[model samples]
Target: MVRHMDERAGVDPRRTDELWLRESERYASTHPRCLQLRERARAHMPHGVPMSWMASYFAHPPVWIDEGHGAHFTCADGIRFLDTNVGDKSTFCGIDPEPVVRAVQRRVAAGSQFMLPTRDALVVAEELARRWKLPSWQFTLSASQANTEAIRLARHATGRRKVLTFTGNYGGHGDEMLTAFAGEGRLSYLGLTPAADRDIDVIGFNDVGALERVLAAGDHACVFTEPALTNEGVVLPEPGFHDALRELTRASGTILLLDETHTLICAPGGLAEKWRLEPDAVVVGKAVGGGLPLGAYGMTAELCEAFERGESLTGRPGELATGGTLFANALSMAAARAALTEVLTPDAYKHASALGAELADRLEAVVAEAGLPWKVQRLGPRSGISFGGRLARNAAEADADEQPELNALLRLCLANRGVWEAISTAGPALSVAATRADVAAYVAAFREFVTDVTGTG
Candidate 1:
């Protein structure tokens, strides 16, 4: 007799290779195109895609998209979806908008990259200053580079070797950022060298006392943070928590680096402008490039001067661990310029922010009616649904439960029913490109799925 896994909160442990294989068999029967493409990808591309993160799309291989426009992408089989996983938030305006597409088309005709600098980069830097109120800026190809560069700037200027971050934080895969806390200590993710272990420190988020103790004892260069913990799965800062953190970092002379790669989905200005956050350095990547690969960091004039004066940690500057050869290529720059200027406007935020709340309400109502033990959390437009009622404030809380069966069921159900989701996020948050009705469609699908799966009569 097959044991029925009791539905609980968090990620369920019912998922194994056998279960996944069974699901894959079923998925392939319907999505023949996807199966064929996945097999093709496996033949050449490791896991069928260049990016491993993309490969980690729950169980089945993610469907390959043919093209995207407005709020959705058309998959290889010509299925148009409400694309919540907009290039994993890289497609800020959803798929491809006309303005961004036109800009790329026009710029492509003119030229792509020239290796020197373009007028767009200058405009982008000025836009950074104007919107973020920071004085200087740098560019790169991905958020990882932006973050690594920020740390380099911090350590160089301060001559401090150590960096600090909260537990359950996701600041990109720079070497220093791999440290996660175990009890009171930090542990490096495997294969990282000894130097990474020595230089990075960890503290618990929203725990002021631990932070104070760490800061007080530290000779640290910078404190890297997400305004709210996002990667360990969408945790938010407690009220006044950020204010206190800012004060503590200032007191300790530790440069505060805010990584806004995911949080930018909330609005045009991101969390810094939205919450009036003040950081010595700000790193933003992903969506800013209008789906192109782009990463950027901004700082004040003083820090820029320190960098210029050779006070930076780079006493011997070689190939920057912070970037690649095509760091600020013109194609990416032109695309970013268009996105920053035209796509991420105030009106878009109003739509997405409002839709985010509505989606949560709908989900909550459906869950309550179904008696499913689940909870959803949202910050502006960035939202997530987990397996419990109490919202997770830390990584531990977020990890307290993992409903594997539910997540898989939900993903397959939604995809089969004509809605697409990340399985990690709440409602893919609303995009400027989304119609009010388009955002609601996911909520409706969820309600229907819960009723159907839970056998709620």
Candidate 2:
């Protein structure tokens, strides 16, 4: 667990609280259009948004987005947001990148789906193999689907029923994965699943002891994790954390599954390649489809051979090496192909990384100069600033000291300052577009919000 160095260094906690509260009130007062959208949306949307997670923010009602272009979003009120959230990091190359759009348009005149795999799927699979160093690939509709499918395949290959994961990670809404640990202990979310059997085990990301204990059990099919658990406020890995993890999983005879849904912002081949960490399977979705719904799991040659030379005697109807009809629909394949071949280049990433780094550095400078108790964490092109000290590790780190009320206010303060992003924008695998002016505006917004909240020059 990473202790809050800021807290250990004796930063004042109450100062953080007061500043965030001030920011929140200022935010609510300025966004009447968002409030109106929330009201209209509530009549139809179960939680005032299509997805319940959208409503989890401190804003009682969330801002409604109208449309997006290269790197900007216009809200219902026509105010342009810097587009940091980018539909939850699904817009990796920035929204509707021209090549991807053209690809989609050209494919749309032909068809949307055929229930038969498309030729673009072949191209995508080949490019994925070339880039990710995996010989085989399969597609699904979402990251959750890909993650669960990878788990099932790993279990089927090993003849193990149990799955293992880090304590605070989200790998889609898979039944075995929708569990979280808290003040009491592990429990199911939305009562979706019962603890029929503890088939899944949770360990802290950087905790070697906890990981060793879980892996040594020898019954788990795989250890699934993000390179860093950026989902819960960008908990970066310790030095050599992933290398040790790779070694341990190999020694323990368990497969390592890396979920790159959020880390695509880090590298073209995702965080796995950036760190030179090898895993048995990699599930990457989000940006692969270029703002469309697409998911894929890439695996090594032996895994491909396992499917090819499987136990015919033990084969079941819905066994491993399985997929659905619409797995690689034409439109999704077209976008995926364009995104990989054209948009996701090293140059694109270098441009984004520079802007993101500048924004993060500016945010840290502003907060530190103000003597605020908050801290910022960044990975690749994404970054998030927390109102409390540095988060430790996973959910436990979140629980111990974070004041959500403060974070809520901070997000509002930011929105009020014309910076529209998810509160966890920095950590949620998002990036501002490469344009320096947009990046500068985002920095200006944060600085203004901080100055407003702290009531200092």
Candidate 3:
């Protein structure tokens, strides 16, 4: 059963409320410039921010970043922060990485887009193929678009309209991918048509029995999943989970699509490569373009050949729905190529991994010292503290373990101390450019927060 905040041991609601109040005041005092900018922005944008999600995701008024260099960024208030959030993994290669910046500058001077593929496109595609082991590749502006296209292709290829996705799976915000399980039925998020849940099935992340039962019908075109659930929290797959997943999908003739946009932090080639899991196709994005917008999907040779021939598994010819005018534009292609080749190299991953391990260790130590019932979970260079005694095995447990008030207070405290982390839904991620100093700074700030909250100083 899920435990409420007040029901959890070692956490006092009144103390949490008091700390939240203190942190909120501290945040307001230190962020006057951000407040001023937000007030000005409110005249045009909702909640005084360009994006609706950004408006309420932060603990205080949204910080206006003047510039970012490597693992740090200066807010409008002139305070520099160790940016563990890394633009929510969009800038995982680090802010303004030199290689990507140089490549983007050159590409911009040459013309950003031409509705034509540049030589960099070939280089980027070839690199993606080499990393993910897929022979044919395509590009999109975001992972959401890539997932949408992948689903469409899967439906076309298999002549099946049903899509299977695990609970807490966040590939993208595409319509069909947005539905979640609600009791015996499923419900689509707001703004989505009722038909969004038409043929989509939602199951638990590591439930082999549920998986077997669902795929038994052989009606699903594809089973889209992440190697490990990251968005809800880092829910690692149980032993034999991946094996069962791959085997079931194959026997059922369902297209197995692995979305590694976030899991790429797991290794140079992402979890798909790290675990040697076989999939019909792979989708990646986020850090792929450094700080630019880019998404890519790769397919096996057989899938590509069948797609090119416009033939489904049953040899039915159909009109293909893919490609966009601005897709694979020159600027994005150049950024992706430089990011993969020059910025996010093997050495870079090694550096981030070392710091990530240290950060996780320090966080665990702090939690233990505080006598809190929290557990720290790590996935390569990413680590998150779950407000539970043990690691979550599925999305439901992760959701049950969430402590929103505590998290908000923690984030506000960290921001006031010159450390920035991702939103409540995300954990801290060390970028390729992060240094040991950055990790140390984060640990120090976190320790202070824990001491204040637990009164253990």
Which candidate number has the best TM-score? 3
- What are the per-residue Cα lDDT tens digits for candidate 1 across 242-328? 988999899998999998888887766689988999999999998889888899999888788776774345465433344567888
**318-356, model 3: which lDDT tens digit per residue?**
767889999999999999999999988888888888888
> What are the RMSD figures for all models against the true structure?
3.3, 3.7, 2.2
Taking all chains together, the TM-score of candidate 1 against the true structure is 0.91
Candidate 3 local distance difference test against the native? 0.86
Looking at model 3, residue 323 earns an lDDT score of 90
Local lDDT at 247 for model 2 = 86
Ranking by lDDT: 3, 1, 2
Residue range 297-407, candidate 2, lDDT tens digits: 999887766655555324643436567777778999999999988998888888877777877787789888888767777777777776557756666675555655445
Q: Using lDDT as the measure, which candidate wins? A: 3
lDDT of each: 0.75, 0.74, 0.86
**Higher-lDDT candidate of 1 and 2:** 1
Runs in model 1 deviating more than 4 A are 1-7, 10-26, 181-190, 312-323, 423-427
Q: Please give each candidate's TM-score.
A: 0.91, 0.90, 0.96
Candidate 2 segments whose C-alpha is farther than 4 A from its true place: 1-33, 58-60, 180-188, 308-318, 423-432
Candidate 2 TM-score to native: 0.90
- The alpha-carbon deviation from the true structure for residue 387 of candidate 1, after best TM-score superposition, in angstroms, is 0.8
